[model samples]
Target: MIGSSTGPLTPSRVLIVDLPGPDLTPDQGRLLRQSGFGGVCLFARNFSTEKRTARLVSDIRDALGPHALIATDQEGGAVLRRLDVPMPPSPLALGVLDSEDAAREAGRIAARGLLDLGINWNFAPCLDVNVNTANPVIGERSFGHDPETVARLGVAWALGSEEAGVMASVKHFPGHGDTSQDSHLTLPTVDKPRSELERTEWLPFRRAVQAGVGSVMTAHILYPALDPDAPATLSPAVLSGLLRLDWGYDGVIVTDATDMHAIADRYPAGAAAPLALSAGADTVLSCGHGDMETHTDHRQALLSALREGRLSEARVHGACARLDRAVNRFPGVPAPYTADQRSLDTAQVQRWAEQALTWVGIPPRLDPALPLLLIAPISAPVGGPYGDSLSGAHLATLLKEIYPHLHTVLHDDHDPTAALSLLDRFPGIPVLLATTGRWSLTELPRFLASRLRKEQRSALHLVLWNADQAAELKLPSLISHGFRPANLQALAQALMALR
Candidate 1:
């Protein structure tokens, strides 16, 4: 009964949704056909390889219709959906390198990779400025700690993506950077006063709008200065008043997955979908749907709202019209990246990593010819849809080839005993690397770093993706600002170069 009655426009058309896996199963195809969503957002679960992603996107087009828009986070930093491919470095790395041209090139490279995969939209250039050290989600994903730097590089990236025929969306509007909590887990509050927000948080978003970004995704966090009662997604002041009316962002305003705990724990999807649209969001993104039936609830609610006058006919039509405009503006193009282009892009990223990488205090001495024990602390995966315990299966294999006499082990941060055991057996000055997010850091990991230094044993503390943790680890640390394969390769080469 999800598609039982057809109006001039289906209620589901305003929904941007995601299915369960990589390929489109027959049932999923039927669901896509029945739902007729405006777009499909791909997750790491769906995209592993370019060929597979292209095939899956082709299948989605068939099911959702030829003109259906496809998008992914594909941010190239911590949130890349493509498991294996030549991708650009983190925004922080680019920011540290401090070249607007290179930032633009990185954008084009990432977009072209997605274009080859049949994805038309990229939710990238995470505009969230990483000013707060305790912020868990938007660390290296952000371009820098400064708003001006974020605005400059973010706009450049958006234009680069546009240059390659891909739509770019600047995200977490109003800003999710200063907040300490992750919205995926719970509701976060950015309680800054209006004056401070105007100077800091609002600058990049303002720049993005002036630059004509095709879409803007709203954060789930509550901004008391903007709207006290509701988070940005459900607040009319944030979406309609601030974004649409004042800022003049005529493009589509998409909500970050409402199924995330920030919105989910408070408002049910059925209620949130209609509420978001009424609040001014043109598209409601739902990614955690278990199956077609869950999506059906959102459709039913919107239909109910329309019937009850809770949602106006004009609003539904307006959203559909905007979606149609985006489809026309940024159509899907399955253009492939050539072999030569891949090689050049990879080398460019490697060069950036080499340039941006820096050392703290005296460098730890190690023999390139001697055995090396690398102790990396990675935490348990955050459960549910975004559940992730970062292990690439091939990382160890890749490191083994590059670092001579290298023994890399990704141990749970909670167990220092296991780390000590590994150190005892290896009989080498360990390279203590913390590659996980700050939220996942345990007391034990901090203790291990302190203990290694206290023993007067020379150790190299390598902090990737979180530089704030590097300061806490004291001196003799190397900061990569990211942990992608390219970042790791650059780290290895840099370590070997130390005299």
Candidate 2:
């Protein structure tokens, strides 16, 4: 795209920054206008209420432009940032439902909600096939274990969002599902042969490119099968040679957040910024330590690289051109794309979620007469995505909606004495250990479940995400594969009807 007729290279055009707070200050607005920035990535801190979110978007649009891309990880399951708009079941839940129609509708629902908040990009339809149940980060974020299934549903979801006027991007490309570790914590490697990767990790992404997905986000993990040295985010073979040349993918390539320890601990903002762009990434996600100057540093990093000749001028132009094309293709509107909030079809979404409840081994049809005590893990929130946040008030409200009469004991694994002692009050009641599914896969619930079983009290697991791994615990478990209230509603409804 940098061939002959593209705009001049600029830092703002290729950087999607994260803000410190929900409100954009006057100084920040001035900086944005001056930089002529490309986009903003919203986080959980950005949305306290719909009114405030609307005002934030209004100010952002005023500072940047109507066409400036607004993106967020509203992937509709575990990683939903906005509570005001009810999201449909997660990707894995949709996969379990096995309905292309539902998956597409879910995407449409997610896009419409984001569009209402003036966001144009949904960094979603995680194309990773969840082959490894031990994987801490990917789990329910992925579609399923089957590559083709993931591809089919991912394409459906992508089209649903794109057709709704918000662009959907398939992410953590070349795959993050097989890795046992979280890339946010450290560098992870997918050590498999190229042939093995072809059948597994590469299949869904290849299908996404064929389906005309407008963008692909690179994983920070190393793929020694593809490149011996750098991770996918900074590997030319993975990005340019494999994705662009061999696969013929002509979409914008985005890097995972450079702030993550996988990259940040290794490379500085200035170095990683140029390296990522040079490696064929069209945009660098540099969500610096929650400040305007973090973005300012990254902007200067790219400009400095250009001045220093560390990065090619043509490469910068090309990246900017690809990003601009994507922006033009899926521009953010000034106001809500859908007329009414009812357009989200909450009932229909719930129906799909209901069908996603899956069982491992025999269905633990606990007697409805048994007193139920819900035991959940509690811990400080982890810094990156897919962490310990799900066991909080959101989980409680949803669990309450489904099982009104249920009692709960929130426990930290460090001191299970408080929770275990509470469990004694229930006597012979069945214990429902709710996890952030695998996100809260600490020993707390397992230990408590073992303790309950030892006491001859019945124990059943109602995992809120990653049903694929429920079999690992050898407990009669139900996996919703989604963390939303709708997901819990489905699991509760299934168990209730079973009796």
Candidate 3:
């Protein structure tokens, strides 16, 4: 029946979909085998260890057929989906080196990690230019604020991934870096005109396209200049007219998760799926099917749109063709997956971390003989795919290995009770504050920092994670612009020298 007279049932338009869990359940297996399904996208929850995740990837491919594209957001730093091993330094860390070769080497290491796990598609090389300091997201994720620098680093990263036989998808096009809102929670608006985007925002994406990157993911934010009514993920003028026609990007056009509040708040999957496809998106990335009924309903909606002439056969076939072509460009990883540490040079990564780190006000000369108190905030906003709340605990553990006498306290900066408890317990000691992202000063961390200063105790703040959150926080500070193990290690070494 799948390959029968039914048209929509054959060669599904939706590409890079998600399963319910890590293992291939019966329902998921059937969905994978369905003619209307395209491929798979994995997340942190789907991974346990390197070898286990590799086995899971292999198992999915075996179930869905070898040609099925396996993809994940392997971008180093805060967006890494794989939890088994240490992620490479963030793109901003590489950008600090001002070396295209370093960016390429970092990209190669990231792609090779994915390839060894049998993944062929990596959603990485975030090309968003960090032009706005108040941007809620896309901070250290971006290479830098300069368009030329962003373009050069982005191209090197994309080229490196492709050269390593993995498809690199330059993302959040045309750009999501200038907005103050996060698309995952609300709809972020960019007021720039097409001319402005061409000058600043579009520079990195243009370079990646010219470099023969295999895919491009659309931004979920609204740009009135591009399309007044709809977001770019569902805008014909932006995706088809600009990206497909004018820019001539023949690679697969994947959408940011439609389930995200930016789109899902207004359009349900039944409606959003068809609109995205009609807007020239080659794939609708929907995570968590919810139930069999919901999945069936979504499939039927696309089929109905095609049959009723709402979405033509030509458009569906065109999308499918692009996906097939992208798939064919990159071969799958060899069998018997093993995460060999030799594949990545940890020493080189540490060296890069050291170069990328930036320090502002001088670190206080704390007594190395006395115990040091490290207070850190580690929580992500609701609904984000990345940003673990316990990330600081891991960083603290890594630091303790170097400074065995270091005392680490992990608490939510948003909770006054938690902050007060930690402050009351560790009074009079020189406290080191470590925070992750833009939300660092939201309520808890900001309150705690003020309280620490009012008490006239020695407090030194460090931007251990997202560097852009460094805006407006007047404190003697240090920043790594990344949270990887190597980055943490680099921070420890710097602290030791300051002591």
Candidate 4:
């Protein structure tokens, strides 16, 4: 427990670090430890194989010691951290199955996978109730549009983490699903009344608290009804008064990536740390800009703010206590954190992928004999090893194998214009298989629908391989839970049925 402090305090608990990637160096770890940062987040970019990732994690742990918190954004589907390893279907995919057992199993698989890699903290089980289809960030990364559904699945995911001796961080507190803008580049404001938020946005978070989630991540979006002046990450009323006081969440409170333009673009990095602390965030995730110079400067600024009495020492200690408790609870036993390849040999992945594809709706009569165009956007460049290149290529290859005679054309571009260009080649074609990268088809060219309508295609088979895109394109499309090669058989089957 953290004791109350009447005066200023030092900056001892700050979760300032970036997602480890190919670019991360051993010297960076030493500098982070020396700078008094709390932990580092891992991305697929830092890992090519399970064994290599495990070794990297072990190295980071050895350098940071037991007090440091090593975390990752392993929320499955579009946000998965470990691409080389086997993971369960995305939350939306699970939502289609609508089985609590499946959701729990997904949590278990995810937890075990992370634990094997020496990751103690997971920024996952996004509790944001995705009410808006246009929501650029949350989209299919969320469980579903319904709060109750999100809560049920979120609890299952959290429980799995705790059972596996890993800490689960339920994220984007107060909800971020309704906003149309991306918080990464702008500050999204929720205009809904407090009552609406209570009913929809805050429902999943409340359930997460009841389920005893180990951590909660604050959203950068501003809610006018809650606090017009500041975003949730810097608002005491939103974090302390609502999340802590009213909701009674005793676990660690972490801020979303502070380097995101939503927060960073608005406030000075130095000024935001203390404000976040005072607002009840126990950990501050800084996954972007991992330079030692920026880290040191930010650290000093936070420390000086505490020393100068701008921020309360009690809040700092309170945050540190929660972080310390989390670190202490991490499983210390060493296990094989590397992927063995054999572990992913199970038929369950194939079954689930097929099930998800079916739930997304592929036309019943997809002619395997006809030429099929597999159109999907290129995964974001910043996604590292988990980018669309790996998953996209895997899916394309799988489709080719499943439909040996099916003529396939692969386009990596995400722009609607690019898709339109490809569509021109298949004028008047009745069958089409489309997957819109990470972005939704709704956000794509409205003319695509016009072209489809003009083509009078009744057998258009569209599939969203990305969950975030799946949530927005509800036009009877098939969804691949995760973009794995295992989904190829299902895609082929669905396409063949379209005949």
lDDT of 2: 0.78
Clashing pairs in 1: none
Better of 1 and 2 by lDDT: 1
Candidate 3 — worst ten consecutive residues by lDDT sum? 1-10
Model 1 ranges off by over 4 Å: 1-7, 378-410, 421-440
- TM-scores, one per candidate: 0.92, 0.90, 0.90, 0.86
lDDT tens digits by residue: candidate 1, 1-499: 1211224767788888887888899988888897787779988888766677788999998888865889888776666777566768788888888889988998998888888877899888789988898888888788999999999998899889978878998988989899889898899999999899988889999999998989999999999998998999999999999999999999989999878899888988567999999999988988765565667778888999999999988888888778877877888868877889888888887888788897888887677676777677544454322334345234455556656787776776666777778777865464645455535467876787777777767787777656777778775888886667677788778776763
Local accuracy by lDDT, each model: 0.80, 0.78, 0.77, 0.69
- Which residue pairs overlap in candidate 3's backbone? 413-444
lDDT for position 195 in model 3: 88
Error of 2 at 7 (Å): 4.0
Number of the predicted model whose TM-score against the real structure is largest:
1
Candidate 2 C-alpha lDDT tens digits along 1-499: 2221264556667788888888998988898778877788888888768889888888887887764778888887777887667676778878877778888988888888888878888888799889987787887788889998998898899989888888888989999999888888899999999999999999989988998888899999999989989999999999999999999999989888988889988987546888898899988887864767778778888888888988888887777777767877887774454435554477777777777667765655555554567777653345467533466455656656556667877766557887777786767767677665455456766677677657766667766655654654557777776666677677667777755
Error of 2 at 119 (Å): 1.2
Better of 2 and 3 by lDDT: 2
TM-score of candidate 1 versus the correct structure, residues matched by position: 0.92
Which candidate achieves the best lDDT against the true structure? Answer: 1
Q: For candidate 2, what is the TM-score?
A: 0.90
